[model samples]
Target: MAPVTAVTEATRSWDPYERGCPSRDLLDRIGDKWSILVLGELAQHGTARFTQLRKRLEGVSEKMLTQTLRALERDGLVLRTVHAEVPVRVEYELTALGQTLREPLKVLTQWSMRHTTDVLAARERFDGRAGAV
Candidate 1:
């Protein structure tokens, strides 16, 4: 019989530079606009209902919100709870794994906010140069 081996940090570590790595897929999910916004809202509010999240996000269609939530849930980032009640209440909150991402996402949000004007200016300059050529 072959020898059994225990998993270590090196074995579980993710190298996004490698093609077809699971981390690449995870990066895509977390880097999406919808996912980032959803995570931000959840991080701030702790927990929220479907309608509440929809209202807070603004401009997000029901289908899109549902899809985003489902994807996050599948990735173990968000927890969905359905309460048995007269009205059947449902809510979503970030899981422990998701909580770990809060700080990094917050930093990213701040960075975007800080650079929005610069980014816009750069885009305008690029557009002008492109039009000149």
Candidate 2:
């Protein structure tokens, strides 16, 4: 056991490219297509099983989902539990740290959806201008 001490030094900011940085690993984990969707699902529905995740995420491959869940579990973001029953069952959920990311992820999702029309308009304008030139 150790006693706690107070200090007054500034903490470093997260840079995703630094060598052996947890931030970089974190970015890699959350930047994947499946990770975002999985996290979104868990945030919305709480704990879920593999079957449920696959069904809700539509079009996600079993292999990819398994890989993503394993990676998340390794990174301490997701928890995987197995139950011994007639047919064996497994569930996944966000840890406390993982839950914290939900707010930012939700904001990012909302931003994209809310501005989809604007994004489409921008794309159209760019394509139209490119064609005109």
Strongest candidate by lDDT: 1
lDDT of the structure predicted as candidate 1: 0.97
Assess every candidate by TM-score.
Answer: 0.92, 0.82
Residue-wise lDDT of candidate 2 within 59-115, one digit each (tens)? 999999999999999988899989998799899999998999899999989998999
For model 1, state the Cα shift of residue 69 in Å. Answer: 0.3
Off by over 4 Å in 1: 1-10
| Superposed Cα deviation of residue 91, candidate 2 (Å) | 0.5
* Per-residue error (Å), model 1, residue 120: 0.3
Q: Rate the local accuracy (lDDT) of all candidates.
A: 0.97, 0.90
What does each candidate score in C-alpha RMSD? 2.8, 4.7
Total backbone collisions for each predicted model: 0, 0
